[model samples]
Each structure stands twice: as C-alpha cells, then as structure tokens.
Target chain A: MNTPNSLLIRRSRRSSNLSFVALGLVAVGLVMMPYVVYQSVTSSMVMLFVLVIIASMWNLLAGFGGLVSIGQQAYIGIGAYTVIVMADLGVHPLIGVFFGALTSAMLALPTSWLAFRLRGDYFAVGTWVIAEVYRLVMIKFQFVGGADGKSLVGLSGLDPVMRSALTYWFALGIAILTVLGCFWLLRSRIGLALTAIRDDEVSARAGGIDATRIKRIVYLVSAAGCGLAGGILVVDALRVQPDAIFSVSWSAYMIFIVIIGGIGYLEGPLIGALVFFAMQQFLAEMGTWYLMLLGVLAICAAAWFPKGLWGAFSQKTGFRLFPVGYHVAQRFDTPVDSRAPLFRN
Target chain B: MQILDALAQGILLGGLYTLFAVGLSIMFGVMRIVNLAHGDFAILAAFLAILLVGETSFPVWLVVAITVPAFAAIGYFLQRTLFQQSLNSGPLSTLLVTFGMSIVIQNALLEAFSANPQRLDVGQLATASFPVGPIAIPYIGVLGLMLAILCIVAIELFLRRTATGRMTRAVSDDPDTARLTGANSRHIYGLATGIAFGAVAIAGLLLAARSSVEPTAGSMRLIFAFEAVVIGGLGSLWGTLVGGLSLGVVQTLVAHFDPSSSILAGHLLFLLVLAFRPQGLIPARSL
Candidate 1:
C-alpha cells in the first residue's frame, strides 16, 4: 500500500514545530532527581543510555544514510583510549571526553575516505578489518594497558560524590545533545541528501547529491557519539582496556538495543532500553539462557517488526512523541498546528 | 623440518577446518544467511552425542550415526519455520536473525548441558599416532583428513548428480528466476540446513575428540569458518577446503615458532588475504 505523497507531505508538515513544553518537562524531571538518585546510576547501567544515543546516530547513518558498519567499536575504543591518554597527562576526565570525541571524529575522516569506496557488505567487512587493525595497533602500545587495559583512577583525588554527579550530568548532557543534534540534522538539506542516498544511491548521485560527503559527515558524527560515550564509559568506571572497549560485542549490543527498540526513531532505544533493563533484572540468574532469550527476541522482532517497537507504535498510534522535521501547511488549514510524519518527501 | 612439520599438522587441522567451513559454506551457498548459529549447532551436536554416550554404551561413531539424522531434522524444521520467509530481505535482517538464533542456541545449550566443559573419551586414538619420517602423525588427524575428503567428494557428487541438489543449485543461483521456474525456495532451504546440520554433527564428534566442549566454543569455531568462507571467496566447496588448509597452516606454523603468535598468525593471514584477494583465493560463482 503506497501512501499518497500529498498525504505524506501533509503529515510531514504537522510535525515540524517543537513541543518545547514536553522537552522542558522531561529536562526538569531529570534535573530534579537528587544526588542519591544520580549516584544510584552505575557506570555500566548509565553507559547503556549512552549506547542508545550512539545507536540512534548509527540508525540515522545506516537507516537513513545507508552506511552500514559493523566496526563502529573502532571509534568507541579510540574515544575511550584517547580519554585515558589525556587523563594520564593530567586533564580532568570530564573535559577529556570532549577531546576524545574530537580525536575520534578526526580518525573517522581518513577512514571514511577509504570505507566510502566500498558498498553494501563490503563496507561492513572493511570496517571490521579496519577495527581489527586498530586493535592490533593498540596492542602494540604499552601506556594504556595495551590489550590488557588499565584503570582510569590514576588521578583518584576527585571526590566520589562529585565524580558521580559530574559523570551523570556529562552523560545526560551528551545524550540530550546527541538526540537534539540528530533531530536538527535530519531536517536540514544534508539530511535530505542522506535520505535520498539511503533510498537509492545511484539516483541520488545522479540528482547531484554528494552521497560520499554526506555519508562522511554521518560517519564522523556517529564516531563522535560513540567516542564520547566510550570516553564517558571509561571515566565512569575509571578504567580503559582495549579488548574490553573494542570488542565487537560493544557494537553488537548497540545493534541489539537499536533493533529491539526501533532503529529509525529516537524513542525506540529509550523504550527498548527500559524493556531490556527490566528483562535483565528478572533473568539475571539464568546466565546463558538470558543472552539466548534476548537473541531469540531480537531475531523474532527483526523478522516481524522491521520498523522496531517505536516504529510499530507510531504506525498503530499514528502519534509522534519525539517528532523531527514537519510538513508545515502554507494554507494553515488546521488550528494550533498538529504533528505529522517526518519522512514525507 | 619444523616448517614441514607445521605444514603437515596444519593440513591435519585443516581437516577440522574442512568440517567447519563446509557446513557453513553449504548453508551460505544455499541459503545465504551465513547461519550465525552454525557454530552453536556444532556445539549442540557435541552435547547431544555426549548425552547419547550416557544413555547407551554405544561407540562415538554410533552416537554420531544417531544424532546426525536427528539434528538434520531439527535444522529442517528451523529453516521451514523461521528462515525461509525471511531470506530475501537483504543481509542485515538475515544476519540479525541468525545472530539471534546463535544466542538462543548458546543459552539453550548452557541450560541443558550446564556450564561445565566436557571431553569425549576417544580412548587411545587421540594419544596414539602413526610414525612418519622423523615425525609422528596421529591416526585421528589422518582419519579427519580422510573424513573431510570423503564428505567433500560426496557433497560435490550430490550437488552435481542429484535432482534435489540441482534444485539447490538453481535456487542458490537465481532465486527469483528459480521461483519463476517453480522451485520452492523454503523447501530447498530446509533441505540445505538439514544437510548442513547433519554434517555438523560429524564435525562435532571430531571436535570432541580433538578438544573439550562448552557453550562459548561455537563463536570461536564460527570465526574460523567465517574466515575460511570469506578467504575462499564463497567461490566453491573446493575453495573453502583450500581456505581452511591455508588458515590451519598459518596457525600451525606460527604456533610452531611461538605459541602466542598462533592466533595472531591466523588473524594476520585473514587480513592479508582480505587486503589482497577480497574476492577470496577461489570464489563460488554466486555467494
């Protein structure tokens, strides 16, 4: 059932305006949480939220930009190690996260130049190989625990309460910024070019969309997100290990969260994470069965709910929670402006 | 002498590599899902064989005999129910589906078999060896090599000679056209998975004979098989055999020189091959 373009356009028009009230309420709720509640967030648990942010970026890249990569952990490891290195030089870990993100973005530049040459699964395999190369190189270096990894608490002079609060705030800010950044980007011209490339790269190129360049931007942004997340992850734990940080499972976890939640929408990871967290709590003792059940759920969801939990929700409810872009009606047929589908071209 | 020794040993390991890659290659060649759960299936077979050992005082060979058919039946059902409808939706969807299956199998195996590692008591075959010029080669190694050769040949003949095999070839080659030609792809995938899992059961026997088994072992085996398939270029069955041998030889040679470098050497070989021959040493016509 192909939807009429005009209806899609009308729908898109309605979702453009931001619901600032909703955004404010959410932001206020987060800020209102006390230090104890903030401290209650463990590094691994908090980092899962960061993973959702990174996955959203990847979803944009692969889902909307059509750049599938299995090696985003390369940037993640790079980001994490960069933080450790910077901190070793006496920089505050919080500030080190920004630098780490920048470093990862810089690394993605050369990688994108090479990876951009490949297409489909070749691109994915190239990324994996590149990640391995990065891992090998990291192993040769001695300062950051090499393959064995190192503790990030070398500068443990900072107060514990302060550390947790700052780390929590940093993670939250990054998460918000990442989500907001994606929302803004998805509405712009580059976002249009990316969406075009995703649908049909050849035709998109023929239409003078610089597919390679847009893909490069998406890649760099995704790297920054993963890198920052990785940095935060290391800082929260005050540890850095190449194998632990760079393991393919890191990216696999991102994929799982994204797939289960909803890859194409911002709300997917949030909903999926809540569900995942609950599942983890209940089935923690089952060990391997827990992983297996999640795997089965992921497979079943992917096969049946390709759009994911949020995607399915949107289709059923026809409601937009975190809508980006919009179909603004020039005629002003509806009062108070309404929400519409964002992907309408 | 050491290099020669390594090469001979690599060839022997290649026998297991053959067992690993052949099943994966066959599934990929036919269904194209990469069967991420392929290695887990091997582990499952090993567990089943161990259970059979407990129930009856049957020879390991007898256990292999019983489990192969049983696993094939399971594979057939899994394909028909889960994989067939989802086959054509591009690689990521399929990859995700298979990955999920892998997790499921691993967890299921853990629950059923517990986390403790088990070893197959192959009596003296593993410890016993045949004398060669200045070197001793184990009988199990030779037996593995022969088994690989026999199975490869049998699969080749089956594909080349049989009607069902021809259908498998046709569907694998041009699925849409095959559909137009009245080939039922789901049934073919079921048959293909059945055969792949069936062979995987035998591979499990050899694996249990060679080393201990546990839940986590499948992913490692999967990586080796995956490397072989990629290195071979999904070119053909023979290519996987060559790929497996080359990988085994690389690992053995490195291990002969230094133990830590063994894993590194195999991974390095993959990187080198991928850089130079991304198409693989030999590629199947369609992969």
Candidate 2:
C-alpha cells in the first residue's frame, strides 16, 4: 500500500544495515589480529593500516575536493621529522604523533596560499615543487639530523613485541578514525559542498558554496592525515631518513590505491589497500617488475574503468556498503507495512 | 671569476632545460595535457642511445639522427592511440595515464639497464673547453645551446608559417570549429606531439652528453623542465629560454656560494616567479 500523499527521504538501506554488521565484525577481527596472528603478520598489518589512512585522506582531497596533489609526501616527511624531533626533545614518540598532525595542518595553511595560485594540473606540479622545497630545506637543518636523518630515540626501552602491538593498535585506531571522519564529513553540509565543487567549480560557486574555504579545509585534513601516517611509518621503521620519508613514491602509492579501488567512494580505499597489500606480498620477489605491472594496471583502470573496481561493482548491484547518497521512498497517509521495501523505486 | 664561470655554465644548463621544456610546452599548448612522462621519454631516449652506442658500430651523431626521427614516429603513434583516447575521457584520465607511463618507463629502464648511471661517450668533446676571460665554456655546452636555439627557431617557424602548423593552431583554439571546417584535430595533435618528441630526444642526447643519466634521473628533469615552462609562461617558446636561463643562473650562483643549495635555489626562484608573476617573464602574444 503506497501512500501517494507522503514520501520519506533517508540514506540507509537494508544493504547498509547488513554492511554495518559486516564492518563491525571486520573491525573486531582487526583489533584481535595481534592475538591470533604471528608478530611478523601484525607488523605487516601495520603498513596496511597506514595505507588506509593515507589513501582515505588522498581520496578526500583529490576525489572529493578535486585537488589532485602529486606532492603530499611533503607532509609525510614533516610528520615523520616532527615525531623524531619531538622524541629528541625528550617528548614521547607516541605523543609526538599528534604533534605531527598538528604541525602538518599548521604548515598546510601557508602551503595552500602558495599552491592555490595554480589551478588544475598546474596545481599538481606546484605542490610537487613545494614538496621538493621541503625536502631540500629539511636536508639543510643539521639540528634535525639534516640529510642523514634521525632515529626514533625514545622507543629504545619498550619491549619489541609490546612496541609492535602498540604501534599496530595506534595505526588501526587512526585508520578507523580517518575513514569514519571522512564518512561523517561527507554526510555533513561541507561534504555536499565538496561534491558540488568536484562536479563543477563555477556552478558550485554560483550556487553559494564557498569553494575555496571548503577546499582549504579538505587540504588541511589531508595533510594532517598523511602526517599521522608518516609518524606511524617512522615508528615502525625506527629511523627517519629524509630521502626515504619525503620520496614521491608515497604519492604514487596513494594515487594508485585511490585509482584502483575507487576514486570518490569511501569504501574504495579499504578494498584497494587489501589488493595492494596482497600484491606487495606476492610480488616481493619480482623486484621493480611488479611496480611496472602496478603502473600498467593503474593506467588500464584509469582508461577503461574510470569508476574503478569498487565503483563498477556497486554500479552493477546497486548495493552500497557505505550509502552516502539519499533515496526517497513513497509512503501512504495511513499506516504502512512494517517491512520497508528494500527496492524503493 | 668564479661567478662569471658559473654564469656561463648556467647559461649552458639553461639551454638544456629549454630543450626539455619546449616539448612539454608543445604538448600542453596543443592538447591541454601535461605529459608527465615527458622526462621519462627523454631518459628512455638517452638509455636507447647508450645501448645503440654500445652495441652498434655507428657514430654518436648517426645514432642521434636515427633515434630522433624514430621517436617522432613513436610519438605520433602514441598520441593517435594512447594519449588521444585518454584525452577523450577527460583531463584526469590524461594525467593518470601519463603518470602511470612515467612509472612504467622508469621501472622498465631500471630493469633493462641496472641502476648505474651511464653517459653517452662523446670522447674528447667531454674534456675539451675554451676559456673566455676568466670563464670556461665547454664545446658540448655550446653545441647544446645551438641545438636548443635551432629547435626552438625551427618549431616557431613551423607553427607560424606552415599550413599544417596553422591547422594545429586552429584545432588548439577551437577543436569543434576546426573539425567542422575539415581539419582533423587528431592528426594535427599527432603532428604536434611528434615535433615535441623529436625535440625531447635531442634534449635527452644533450643531457647524456653533458652528464650521466640513470633510470631515476627523469623525475628531476621533469621538475626542472616544468619549472622552466611555468616561469617562462605556458605556450611561449621564447619565454622558455628566458625562464630556463634565469633558473640556471640562480642555481649555478647558489652552488658557487653553497654547493648543496644549488637545486634548492633554482626551485626557490621558480616559486618566486610563480608567486609574483604567474604570467611568466615574457608571456607570448598567442602561441
């Protein structure tokens, strides 16, 4: 009995509810991973979490905000460096992680002013140049270890197993926070403005969206998130080398993950990270050949499947694990059936 | 004397950079696509030249002559197929495709020719240089500067005078109108890319002659070329020379004072130009 008089608008569907349960299960399993898996396995999982955080942040910036930055490793280096420096100053490395995020966000405010001068593709190269600037500047600062870089000083006393577990937990928590934060941000008014800006900047501005302000906010968030990931990376590696930390390869990984999994979708990074991690593990023996293959696959995905693997899958099934869009359902004036129709055409 | 020497060397370095940038400018001007693989393609040419020199009995000049034309053909085919399709999809697709190509080319080169840096054996030319006052100018550097000027002049003339060049300009200005009026935009685009590729191959040969090149050397070259283009102003051929020269002078001067800061100084100059004068030192009237 369809009520012609009234229509109900909502976001979640039956599939979303099922997805919630599945996600909750996955979360619990991830939290319990260290207990069940070997130490080496948990150590590798730490990298997976870092990838998730960085990829999600990148998606927020490029996919949603239309800022295709190719130099995000600047913040990654800053974050790692901040953590190392903080530890050198006698502050705990764990506490320094937050400082990493804070420092990156603070630096991003100034960087946006310079980077925003160039539009579209030029913006991409501008950011890369800025990142190069950051790397060169870092190399000059001998107090912060200069080109030689510094080690994670404060973590010398912690037990190896305990430290790894703690690192894993921190990574997991941050990855989850990044994803949920992005989900909530998208569901808010700012997210709507970002979607509009992404589709067409001129129209979005014409429609009263403060495109610059929103884009700035997204850029800051992305910088902070990448910074946090960098902090985690240094803790895992136990040393911070300027060249290794600030390498553009980090940007390449983020771009490849976003393009392969799904560009705009929230779930895309998660799925892409799993696939990337698997590939990294299996193709470890292949040296740089596997990277070439990854590059080829990314090109194919961009050319043929522009929507990416997750995007194509969702388009076919009309099922969203993270239903970020609204749908309308018809309701009668009288009491309707308790079971809401799943397919609300 | 040191400063004078640096300036002379810097001018020569700028010539090399101008060569790299001209190809990039052509691609961007015609297609509104920044070829991220521009540097990688240049590197590939250098590597190929090295291989040819090692394996074949041909002279270096003969190898360069063969490779330049060969790369032009390759460029035309790539544009007709890979780049054209990516362009049809949109700007993001083009960026991703080119970026992916950069990584693929880099890794493939690494696989084929180890990580060791290799240089083109220009024999006695590498060591020969003449002194002017307190400054020394290498014969190879002068050759590169002459080549750079020659390529830019040739391209400028081609785009300005040739009928096909007019077709390219028309397509760039209004693709839809050009298509309606009987010009095949695709073919014109291919021609532009072919010219760019040929120019970049020359840059590669020069780079190899000047210094050693490795698989990983392409990214910095891309940055240098990109900086030159932006500082010179997009779509302006002569402006690229101005931009490249300024960048080279700044880097060399900085290196004279503090060795580690040479590249940083060049990058800083570029950023300053970008911040203060985004239009470039001498913006073209219309490319």
Candidate 3:
C-alpha cells in the first residue's frame, strides 16, 4: 500500500551534463570563429545570427504568445532607421544600435495599443498595414535620405578587419543572449502562464491568469528582440533603405525559419536558421526558383509537419536540448538497486 | 471645382477598389478564411489576360471572358486540393499556407514575366474623358465604376437568391451543422472561393486596363484590398463600397496636399479606423 506522502513531485530535466558540454563547445567555437573564418564568411555568420534572433522573437510572439503578427518588419525597419538617424547625428554606430533598439521598444508600446484592438487574423493584417505606413512615412523623411536611402557615415574610420570582427562578435553575443533570455523567461512562472494562454486563451483567463497583460508583455519583448536584430542588421549592411529594410520578405523569412525549425520550441529557430542559411548559400543563384522552392517547402511543412522539423523529431525521440516544460516521473521508496531504476530511463 | 474633380476621380477609383475588396469580403464572410494570396491571384489573372490577348490577338473583353471562368475553375480546384486540407488545421496554418502560396505565385510570376511592367492597351478609352458638370472623368473610369456596380449587384443577387449561396452561409455559420443537414460544406467552400476568384479575375483585367502591372504588384493590391475590407467591416457587401470610396477619397485628398503622401495617407486612415472603429464603419453581426 502506498501513502499520499510517498508520491513524488518530479519535474522535467532542465539540462543534462551533455547539454553543458555542447554549450561550452559552441561558445569556444564562436569565440574563435573570426580567427578561423574569412571576412566573407564572417558576414554570412552575422546574417545567420540576425536570422536566428528574428526567428526566435517571432517564434516567441506567435508560438507562445498566440499573437500571429505579420508586421514584425515594422520594428526591423524602425530599428534600422533609428540606428541610421543616430549615426547620421554623430553617434557611434555601436552605440546607435543600442539606441535603435530602445526606440523600437518605445514605439512598440503605442503600436501594441492600436494592434491589440483587433483579434486573431485581423491582428495579422493590421500589423502589416502599420508596417507599410511606417515604410511610407520613412520614405518622406528626406533627412534620412528618404526613398533613396543613405549609407552609414559613422563607421568609415574603423579598420575593415576590426569592424567586421567586432560586428560578428556583437551579433554572436546578441544571438546567444536572446536565446538564453527566452529560455530563462519560459522557465519562470510567466512562462507557465504563456503556455496556458497558447493552449487556450479563454481557459487561461478562466484559470485566473491576466491573459491581456501577459500578451502585452510578450508583444513588447518580441518587439525589443526584433528591434535588436534590426539594429545589428543596419550596422552589418552599413546602409539603410526603407524599401529594403521594410520589405515583407523579412517577415516571410522569419516565418519560414520559425516554421521549419519548430515554432514553439527554443531549439527550433537555431536549427531553422542554420538550414535556411545553408539553403540560401547553395540555391541563391537560382533566383526565383529558390523563392518558389521555399514557398513549396513551407506549404508542405504546414500540411504534413505542423509541429515542424525539430518539433516532430523531438516528439518521436523524446529528446529536448532546452526543456522548458514539466515531465512526470515515478518515485520508489527504496534506493535504486542494480536491477531496478527509480525513474524511467 | 478642383476639389470636385478629385472627389469624382476618387469615386471612380473607389469603384476599382470596391472590385478589389468585394471578393475578399465574400471569402471572409462565407469561408472565414483570409486568402493572403488574394492579390496574387488577381495579378495572376491579369497576366493570364495579357498573355491571352498577346497570343490570340483577342480584344480585352474577349480575354476577360476567357480568363474569368478559367480563374473560377482554378479556384475551385485549389480549394478542393490544397486549401481544404488546411481549413480544419486552424487559422494560423491557413494563414501560413496561403502566405506560402502568395510567395510561390509572386516568384513564379517573376520568373515567367521577369521584372518588366506590362499594361493592357485600352485603345481610346485609356485617355478619353468627358465632362460632367464641372468635373472631367475618364471613359475607363466610368466603365470601371459601371462594371464594379454590375458585379456587386450580380454577386449580391447570387448570394440572396441562390441555393448554393445559402448553403455557403450555412457552412460558414456552423460547418458541422451544415454537414449534418446533408450540405457538402467542402463543395460549398469551393464554390464560394470560385465565385470570389471570378470577381478577382474581372477586377484584374480592369486593373491591367487602368495601369501597368508587374509580378510584385500583387502585394500593394493586397494591402489596398485589405484596407477596404477592414474599413467596410467583415461581412457587409455594400459597406465594402463605402469603405473603398473612403479609401480612394482619402488618398486623393492627401495627394492634393502632397503627392508623396498619397499612399501614406491611405495607410494612416486605415490605422485610424483600426484604432477608433475596429468594427469598421458599418459593423456586421457574427457570421
């Protein structure tokens, strides 16, 4: 006979020794990447970092927050523009990037008030409209070079090699920090609320959670993260253009990466970004064919693998590199013998 | 007189916008699916009309006659084959799949037609205009307005008087109940999409006659269509006309002040509408 007190309150494994080892290995590799790779390769790496950051933030917004926004490019464009304006005003490019992110976050506060008025699919299109408005408004600002755009004048004095190296490191740092921040946030109490909200908003509200408040918080965070990526993007390009930065293709690419990787999982964006970068490297010369292929791939993925690549893979294998949810386990009274285990292996 | 000219032109432009929006409204009202690729399909129809006219030396009217029904068939088949699968998956999946379709259509058009813009030759109608009191309106504009009204009336009659249309309404209201009542909801959805596509096809031909179109043109068309739909409210057919006219007038009025601010003004109005009257000018009850 078992007593009520004998029951165990087991939780999911947060990290394994192997996960730590992998993390250490990745950190070491990234730290040494500039020395090992060419300048061109470093630029590609910076791009990959930006994709990962954008995809991760998108995943956070849509997958967890249940806000399927299609207008995230607004923040990306705004962030880029902010950085450019700051640089033009004689601020250091590095410092400008930070201010750009701040500006985006501040802007998001008001944008959310307008955007949150709509629900579900309406919200998606509303965001896109807002982004278009942002782009159009940016085009009218001739001081920032308007529709023609302008190059960053602030970074002209830095050595080419040193600038590239610094940008790469900054990108790498931002990418890792963004992922880590997401993981930490998801592991907290708020994460549990988000999970509940994602599964069922009405039920989550019924369960005493402030669904609106939490969603607003998530929206703001997502904006800040995307803004950071946007800031980094302008620095890497050393040029800012409304047409280029505000392009819907940015949103499309983010969607592709998040969906391919696994929308709801932390590890999904990382894998998706890598896969996308690899595909772009090989198939980019195919031009329209590459884009068409991406579209086909997304359609197929949506139909068959709604859980995404990593999502399906994790479900089958029962493996999680960054576990944020609880896993139940059995507890035994006696210490584990050689023949028997206390928890399922 | 100047303001009157802008208003008259805006009203005529509104007719074109109504054409763009009505199809979107019907699809949303009946299917509860926002076809992200709606504008791309319109662009595709325009290109198809251009190709048909170019290859066969058919008149623009003849080309429209050929393409509209063909578009309906394409829409029917697409809903049956591709969109049907995603319908039950949830709105997010439908959105993603349709977005993917948009990308595919846009890229395919780019590949097939290159980046060059193409315009349909309307002969004398392109430049011809007649004075109405103090305002001058182009012949094409009047034709576009008349066609828009005709299409809207036809679609309204079809929905109200037809059995299939009622079934579509039923399916949209409650799919399971409609299914229980022996209505093939899937088939009804297909028909609804087909009708919507037919409207889009005509709009596409009209659009080509009005201006040049390229592969990427669909996106702006989509934004305009979406704005009209939102401004009109979700399920009101007549409100779409009002919405479209409002959008057109706002753009023209803004352009009057500064030509560069034309598109921006429309977008700003959309945002204002969204903020103040999210239910739109004429709100509809639940579908």
Each candidate's DockQ: 0.42, 0.76, 0.78
Q: Pick the candidate with the highest TM-score.
A: 2
Instruction: Please provide, for model 1 over A1-345, each residue's C-alpha lDDT reduced to its tens digit, 9 standing for 90 to 100.
Output: 223322334333233235456666867676555443646654445665676677776787677776767789998889889888888898877888899899999999987766665455446655766776678778878887777888885448878877676677778788878877887787778877877887788999999988878888889999988888888888887887787788777666767877888876767777776677777768868787678778878888877777888888788976666655454344333332235543444
Q: Between 2 and 3, whose lDDT is larger?
A: 2
In model 1, the runs with Cα more than 4 Å from the true position are A1-20, A35-38, A41-45, A65-70, A106-140, A153-155, A201-217, A322-345, B88-91
What lDDT score is found at residue B41 in candidate 2?
A: 94
Native-referenced DockQ of model 2: 0.76
Can you write out model 2's per-residue Cα lDDT over B173-246, one digit (the tens) per residue? 88999999999999999999999999999899889988999998988988999999889987799999888888
The list of candidate 2 runs beyond 4 A from truth reads A1-6, A331-345
* Deviation of model 2 at A34, angstroms: 1.1
- For candidate 1, the chain B TM-score comes to 0.94
Off by over 4 Å in 3: A1-17, A333-345
Candidate 2 has which clashing residue pairs, if any? A3-A331, A3-A332
lDDT of 2 by residue, A219-272 (tens): 999999999999999989999999999999888889899999999999899988
TM values, all candidates? 0.89, 0.96, 0.95
Q: What docking tier does model 3 reach? A: medium
Model 3 lDDT, full chain set? 0.86
TM-score of 1: 0.89
Instruction: Write down the lDDT of every candidate, Cα atoms only.
Output: 0.77, 0.90, 0.86
